[model samples]
Target: MAIHRWRFVGIFILLAILGGAAMVMWNFIGLLLVSFAMAYIIYPLAGYFSGGNRKAGRKYLTACLSSVLLVALPVIYIMIYSLNVILQWLIENFGMIQSGSFTEGLKSGLDSAGFGVVSERLGSELGRLISSATDALWTQVTQPTWFLETSISLALFFVATFYFLYEGPRLMELIKKHIPTREKFLHELMSTIDKIFYGLFIGHLLTSVIIAGLAAVGFWAILRPPLITLGFLVGMMFVVSFLPLIGPWLMYVPMGLWYMALLPGGTMPGILILIYGSLMLTIVPDFYIRPKLVRRDADIHPLLILLGFFGGPFVMGFKGIIIGPLVLGLAQAIVMLYIEKRHILEDLFKRL
Candidate 1:
């Protein structure tokens, strides 16, 4: 009896120590989670590469290639293209971006909106904010410490991601082995999570890709910003997919405003882009296309997904967005499992 009690105490102590360590490393936890999430997102590619044969060496090689294809290659292209666009924009419009014309235009818009007082306040606030930000940026440019820290963090992020991708399946299996519950229940929950993850991530990715292509074509005819930059912004709409109904508009409307308010002879094209984008890209794709894609992959309600998307970011910052939907999915799976085990639905139907 004493030996059993001591063993229990030892286990408890170990858990306490681990929990403390986890708390201490909470900041890095986000990086770890991001790596794991990336691994999960690209697991299908890894599987395809393995061709149903699970050799450790092959799995690692496949994981590396998958990461390169999905992440590294795209990022490199985006960076190169985006930097060129940015440099060109600065060369052409450095005077505009840094001048009072921008502020005067914004103030005029605010006055037209019957918010002259707000405009005055906004101007003052923006002046102060820009002053402080410029000073901070100058300091950072003159200093090397922050740059080094950022570089180290970025390196760690990639290293962690590489390992997570390579060992993700093994890690998941190990996690399942230790789940303190009936294997069936655990399996069901995991399966549900898998479905939800794929539904949200892949649905967002596909929709964003389509929207980016459309936006690139649309912007080619209007919106003076580089096609790549505009398309990149459109693609990044997936970041705000939690607020689905309004998110795309948040991007497109601003883009339209940039053209209308900034460039001469841009208002008509800007208005057209706004109307067309809101209708075709934002509404049709979000409400109709996205629902079909997500629902096909995961047996979840659209409203529930919206709630998870919105609520997650509110509660847990960015991580909450992913975690919120996952938690909701897990809860749903548990409820379904309980209903199945107890025949709750059948009982309710009979009673009715």
Candidate 2:
């Protein structure tokens, strides 16, 4: 068969177009990846809501509901609650500073330590710092460009998520149809990827829940923060726990320090809470249970999953949580395929 000369030209043009499109979309890569991941995670829920219906309206509605339930509501709740708690704490503390209570307390403590001379200067400096910080925060938050950009990004994210959920299966079928691969190998590869996704997301979620539960119980028993406040804080911790390195410690450590330094007769409870958090919240669940769960579901080594969890953020920021495990999991899958079909692969290579 004679090769068509224009076919090479067509291929070159297609490649150039794809490269240009990729460059244009590079800034939104994180947003798109997150949307895809969210859609993948919630697809089963979408399926359940659709009840095997193929109607476009039904699929769209189900995708919308699933995205909101699985992603939006929880994210909004965490952000709002965390911000409220932080703002409340700042307001109360600022009130104390304005009322001279905080400065008076600092002065008295400094006088006892022979540092009274510097207390006034320190208080004034702190007040100035807080004022400047508040001004800067207000300025940034009020920026029209920032607000517009954020709004647009959010809109795009939801749209992408909805379509991904609605069209994912069809897209997969289309891809499978075009890909030049044996059905069995492709199925195995896809199944492996699915298992890894399940292991990473579900395992992390369950670990967070378990840690949050432990934190709530510990707070109720030991620290004794207000019930509603404790719940809110624990919920925030649940979200933060998904991140590497910075977990419930963000809440517990500060609370521990506050207990030890601010409250009378709180040193013991503070120490106890710290110990409880370290052992129950951080060490056990994160290190042992999480990896075990991931290993069980993924059928990949716990060590690899752990590396992906911890090392991904270091390498690729937040998305690495998904990407790291996925990359490692894919590498594992490829190796396994090579091992299982070594003879065939070698024979093919020899023929080539």
Candidate 3:
């Protein structure tokens, strides 16, 4: 019995060591996945180049060319340009504007809407509060540190994308080799991941394009910044919405406020309306559009989304929510299947 216990302990230690090794080695695999994601995103464009070539037999060279020149080059350029834009915007307008105090603004607007001398006093107090908030914001930011960080992150992404594009097939084969073929649970898990990610990948791109088009139209109809560039930036943010929860809100709230402020207002009421409208428009896509598109792959509730978004980062870091849920879901599916197959429902639900 002692000898058997020792053997089990030895096996557990070996598995732990292997897990540590895999964690350390994950960078290479991560790069491969990132490249696949990049290539998948631009596959349509690559298809344009390879579509004719497919008519005869098969031409992978067309795909390679399109991926390298069309997908890779453009994406790398955009990443660099975006990094620069972010750095520049930070440097230039570190605090050229602020929202001031919402409480104060509300008080003043209410007073103007009519409440006599009491309202005027409240508005005056609110003005001071807003002034205090805005006054604290005006300052010069040292941007070199920001530029350095941006430079490093983009450089890594570029390097990863480069190698990924360079060695795509071997990675796919490696993935296929590891995936369980015969198990019903494993097969279903694989199916869910492939279906969900593919839909999410395409649906997100379409959503971003649609949102950007709306933003551009709204901007052109009324605002300053150049259309093409602003549209691209906003569209990029919309794409980032794939991350869930805070990502969409972060992108929209500031822009919505900015648009409202820019609207020929001091009219206050109109600005309030605009702010409310923009917020509604921005928030609607997640509830309405995402439900239909993402429902197929992941039947995750919004509460689960919040937990995943927060808990994932705490446990596993930036991309954790994506990786964590995929893993947990697979395990859950496997366990559930086993329970059903063995007619172990009473045991399973009781445990739950």
Local distance difference test, per candidate?
0.66, 0.71, 0.54
Question: By the TM-score metric, which is better: model 2 or model 3?
Answer: 2
Give the higher-lDDT candidate: 2 or 3: 2
Clashing pairs in 3: none
Q: After superposition, how far is residue 72 of candidate 2 from its true place, in Å?
A: 2.1
- Cα-based TM-score, every candidate: 0.67, 0.63, 0.53
Candidate 1 deviation (Cα RMSD):
6.1
Q: Which segments of candidate 3 are over 4 A away from where they belong?
A: 1-23, 26-36, 43-48, 52-58, 92-159, 162-184, 204-221, 225-302, 321-352
Q: Please name the candidate that would achieve the greatest lDDT relative to the true structure.
A: 2
Tens-digit per-residue lDDT, 1-352, candidate 3: 9999999999999999999999876754544444556665555555566663423223645565556665447656876676567556544543432443445555666556555468767766766664564444332124447657645655666556544543444565677778756444445545555554555445554454455555555544544465345745566565455444545556545555644454345344435435543554465555665555554544433344445545765776766545554444445545655665544444445555
Q: Candidate 1, residues 62-138: lDDT per residue as tens digits?
A: 65667546776676577567656755654564455466565566667766655557887786566556546545555
User: What is the per-residue lDDT of model 2 for residues 1-70, given as tens digits with 9 covering 90 to 100?
Assistant: 2367788888999999999999999777778877887776677677766776645686657655665567
Q: Which ten residues in a row have the lowest lDDT in candidate 2?
A: 107-116
| Least well predicted 10-residue stretch by lDDT in candidate 1 | 238-247
TM-score for candidate 1, please give it. 0.67
